[model samples]
Target: MPVFRRRKGNLPRLVPELDDATLGQVRRRLETSWSRGSLDTSVIALVARAIEDAGQDWDRKAHRLEVLAGAAGRAVPDMWRRNSPNDQGAVLLHAWSDLLQAQRGAEVDLAATRDACHLAADLLPADPIPWTLALATLRLERRPHREMSAVWREIKARDLWNREAHLQALAYLSPDECGSTALMLDLLDGIRSVMPPDAPTAGLEIITLVRNYHRAFGADGRAGIGAGEHWRRPDIARALDQAVQDWLRPGFLTHATAVADLNVLAYALVKAARADEALEVLRATNGVATPWPWNTEGDPLERFSHWYGRVGSA
Candidate 1:
C-alpha cells in the first residue's frame, strides 16, 4: 500500500524514501503543493501536521522532517524560516535543506545555518534532529574534529540509536570526507562492539563495506571488470553473512528508517551475487525502496524491479 507502484503492477510500491500510510498522505499533500508552486504558509501547515503526527517518537519525527525537507521545493524552507521564525519545524527544515544543498555543491550560509540549529536545539532540547542536522552540516564544512564530536555527543545523548546521526559520523570520517580510512574503520569497530544487531544502525556496517568496495573499483571498471566475484572476497562475504543472519530476523530492525536500511541490505546482497538472500530481504521491504544503490544503476524503482524479476520465483 505504498504511494508509488511499479509499472506492469506486480510488486509493492517502491518510494525513494521510507514511507508508510501516514507519510504517504503527507507526501501526497507535499506533491500537490509542489505542483501548484506552494507558498510558505501552505507547505508549513502540511509539514507541521506531519510533525504533529510524529508526536514524541524521535525516530519518526526525524524521518518525517528529513523526508519532507528533501521533498520540499528549494525555496520552501527559506520562506518558511523567514515567515515562521519561531516554529521549530521551520527552523530545522531550513537548516536541513541548506545541508542537503551544501552537500550537492551549493553555497549556503554555514554560520546562520549553525545558528538556526542551535536555536532549534534550544527550542526543543529533547529532540536530536537539530543536532543530527548540525552534525551533517559540520561534516560537510569539515569543521574541527572537536566541533563534530560535540554535535555528535548531543545527538547521541538524546537518541542513542539515531540512525542519521551515525550515518553522518560515518560519512564525516570517510576517506572522501574529512577523516581517513583508518578513522572510519575505527568508528565502525567501536559501533560493532556495543550496538545491538537490530538497532537503527544495523545497516551501518554493510553500508560501509559496500561503499568501500565501490570506492576501490569506482564507476570506471565496476561494471566492466569481475564485479560479481569481487563481492565474494572473504571480508565482504563475511559481512554479508552477518547481515543476512542478523538483519533479516523479524522485528529486529524496528526503527523508523528500517525499510530504508533493508533496501541498503537488499542492494548489497544483490551486488554480492546472493540473489536468493536478496529475495527474502526484498520481499520484507513490501515494495518500499530507497533511491540509493538502485539509483546507482538507473531509476531506482526500475532497477529494483529488474532485480526482483530476476529472482522473483526464488
Candidate 2:
C-alpha cells in the first residue's frame, strides 16, 4: 500500500519545501483558463509537471490534474469539429488518458484508457506522453509483460530520456508488484547503458534502489534492514556513487523531479550509515523536501528537516 494515508482529520499535504514557482505558474495559468477553448503548449507542460508532482501525493495531484484535463476535454470536441483534432487536442486526450487511470484509483478501465492513449498517439505521432500513459495503464491493468515491453519500446523510440516513462517502466518491473529484482536491475542497467553518463535519467538507478529497499524493509515483519540487505549491497554502493556524481552535474538540476530523486538518494545514504555522503545530496536539495522515503516516517517535511539537521551538525 502507499505510505500516505488519512490519519484523523485533515488529509496529508505535500512537503512545503517542494513548491516550485514555475510549476505553480503553470497550474495557475491552467486554472485561469479553465473555461477556455483550445489548449496551449503550456497546458501539456503543466500536465507533465502534475505527473512529476504526483510522485508525492497521487490523489491530490489527480484532483488538480483532472481540473486541467476536464477543461481541455471540454474544448476538444469543438476544436475537432472545427479543424480536426490538432496538437492541442492530442495533448488533451493524453491528459484524459492519465486522468482516467488516476480516477479509477487502481480499478482502471484498461480498454477505454488504452483507446484514449492510442487516439492521442495517432493524433500526435511524435509525442512521448501518450506512450508513457499507455505504459502506466498497462502496468495498472496488470497486462501481459510482453505488451508492456512493446509500449515501452514505443516510448523509448520517441524519447529515451523521458523520466516519467522510466518510472512507469520501473513500476511494471517492481519485484513486489509484477516482476523480480533481477528484472528491475536489468531494466535499470539497460537504460543506464544507453544514456549518457550524466543524463538526468541515470538518477533512476539510485531511485529504483531506494524504492526496492523500501519495498523489502517496509514489510510488516521486516521493520528494519539487516546487515546483508540491499543497504549494504555492493551494486547499490556503486550505483549511489555514480548517481551522486551524475546528479551534481550542471544543468541536471533543472528536471521537474530532480529534487525528489535527490531526496531518495539522501534517504538511502542516511539509512546506509553514509551520512557524510548524504550531506552533499541534502545540500543539493536546496531545502526542497519531497514526500517520499520520509512519508514512511510521517510528516515528511519534519523527517526531512530532522535528517538535514543531523547532516548539518555532523
Candidate 3:
C-alpha cells in the first residue's frame, strides 16, 4: 500500500490506500503523465498491465478500475480506444469512466457507453466488471427495476459475491437513487441475514440504515430531529451492535475492500453517538478513510478528524 498522509499530532489525516502497491504506483504514474501532458505507450501499457494483472480477480479488478477511472483524465481512455481500437481494457475503462461522469451529473453518450460495455462483455466474457459498470449505469439512468435485474443476473453468473455488483444493487434499491424506502428495506432484509460477516459488504446493513437515517434528516445530513433518534431505534441499534461485535474480530473481513466496510463501521458508530466504540475500527483502517457517509454531512476529512478527537479525548 502507498501511503499519502498529512498527519498532525491528533488530527485524522487519511487518504486512499490500495491493497495492491502496484495500483498505487499506477495512480502516481498516471498523475505524472497528466502533469507532463504526455499520453504514450507507457500510459496504455501501465493501465493495461494493471488490469491484466488483476486478471479474473473480480474484486481487485473493480477497485483497480475505479481508482483508474477516478484518477484518470477522460482523455486517457479515449486515446487508448482510438489507438488500440480493439483493446478490452480500453473499452472497459472508457465505459466505466464515462458512467462515473454521468453519475456526477455530466452529460455523456450513454448509447456509446452501453455499446462499450457490450464490447467489453464479449471481449472478456468471463469478467464481471463490464456488467457491474453496466449495473451502475442502469442505476444512474433510473432504468426500470426489471432491466437492472437482468443486468444483475449477468453479473451474478460471472461473480456472485462481487462487492461492487451487490453495492450497485443496494444503491439501485436505495431511496437515494430510484427505489422507495420500503423497497430499500426489503433489499436490506435479503442482505442482512445472509451476507457473510467478512464479505466485501460486511457492513451493508449499517450503510442502508445510515443512508435512511440521513434521508429523514435531509440531503445535508442535518435537518430533521423531532425528539426521537433513528440510531436508537431497536433494529438499527442491533445492526450496529452486530457490526461492532463481529467486524473487529481477528481474521474477519479479508476482502480487498475490507477498509471500506471498516469505514462504514466507524462512521455508523460515531453517527449513533458511539464515537468511543469507533476507536478500534478507526485504528484498523490505519488512516484510510472514504468520502461517503461522512461526505453527506460535511467535509469528509473534517468530520472524521472531529470524531478522531472526540473519541480520543474521551
**Per-prediction TM-score to the true structure, in the order listed:** 0.88, 0.72, 0.88
Task: Estimate, for each residue in 54-83, the C-alpha lDDT of model 3 and write its tens digit.
Answer: 877788888888888888869888888888
User: What's the distance in Å from true for residue 102, model 1?
Assistant: 2.2
Tens digit of lDDT per residue, candidate 2, span 263-303? Answer: 88898887778877887787677667777778787778788
Pairs clashing within candidate 1: none
Candidate 1 contains a number of clashing pairs equal to 0
Residue 190 lDDT (model 1): 93
Q: Write the per-residue lDDT of candidate 1 for residues 22-90, one digit (tens) a residue.
A: 776777778887888655476567778887778768878888877777788577787778888988988
How far does residue 204 in candidate 2 sit from its true spot (Å)? Answer: 1.5
Model 3: residues with Cα > 4 Å off, grouped in runs:
1-11, 17-20, 219-228, 310-314
lDDT of 2: 0.64
Clashes of 3: 0
By summed lDDT, the worst window of 10 consecutive residues in model 1 runs over: 1-10
lDDT of 3: 0.78
Candidate 1 scores a C-alpha RMSD against the true structure in Å of 3.3
Against the true structure, candidate 3 reaches a TM-score of 0.88
Our model 2 lands, by Cα RMSD against the true structure, at 8.2
